[model samples]
Target: MKNLVIIGGTMGVGKTATCRELQKCLPRNVFLDGDWCWDMHPFVVTEETVRMVESNIAHLLTGFLDCSEFDNVIFCWVLHEQRILDNLLSRVNHGGFAIHTFSLVSDEAALSERLSRDIAAGKRDPAVIERSLARLPLYGELDTVKIDVTDISAAAAATRIKDFLAA
Candidate 1:
């Protein structure tokens, strides 16, 4: 069976970590970080870049959908709103797979600590951290599987996703 899993949340909430853990459960999978497509320095997100990014995600998903070796195709990004989710997903091929989406979440303090670590490691911009934290309430508004990583391991969150899929 083919499965497309889209993990979304505010930055520093452990979306990528959970996705990586999910890979352990379903190793024969194709995983793509959506930011890998268009996160570049001198970042200027105009309408054109947004369109290009959506197209790029669509192209990658279509390729993964065609690859039978992958039992699961996973993509994780900060899709803070339903419109953004719909915009990118509509571009995908929808290759007859059951698509599961989950939103990772955490308290502001935990999120702050995570982002601060990322900032210290120089893996993330300080501005992005502020912006992401400001959007915490927006994440809670999403209508999808919600996993709070404030007190749980990424593996535990992945286990919950697996259990949900099993049921």
Candidate 2:
């Protein structure tokens, strides 16, 4: 059976990193980062753009799901709202696929520290700290298995997720 693992978290919460690690842990895995769909110049957010990006994401994810070479499809994004998750899931054809959703969460201190490091390294903007912190609580409201990644490495988090899938 195909495994469709959806991972959501705030910016700088290591969703990309964890998914990258998970790709290695899972057999015949493919990884997709939702940010790739909207990585446009002067990133604009409107109803049209949102719809377009959602369509694009759904297209790519559906392609991955339909492919025969991969048994595990891992997708990660800053999915802070349940509506967004619902919309994405609705768009994708997940029949016969075991869907596992996860929300990577952390305390404020840990989140701030991680974002600060990213900011200092020029990997992320400083403004992401506050924005990420604000969305931290929103993950709790999502209907997903919560994984506290405050003190764990990305590989460790990936291992935990793999173990969950194995069980």
Give each model a TM-score. Answer: 0.94, 0.98
Best by TM-score: 2
Best by lDDT: 2
Q: Give the TM-score comparing model 2 with the true structure, all chains together.
A: 0.98
* Alpha carbon deviation, residue 4, candidate 2 (Å): 0.5
- Per-residue lDDT tens digits of candidate 2, residues 54-134? 999999999999999999999999999999999999999968799999999999999999999988999888889988999
Query: For residues 1-167, what per-residue lDDT tens digits would candidate 1 score against the true structure?
Result: 78888999998899888999999997579889988988788777999998898898989998998888888998999999988888877888886788898899899899999999999999988897789888878877776788888999999999998888888
What is the lDDT, from 0 to 100, of the residue 42 in candidate 1?
75
The C-alpha lDDT values of all candidates are 0.88, 0.95
Clashes of 1: 0
- Model 2 CA lDDT for position 1: 89
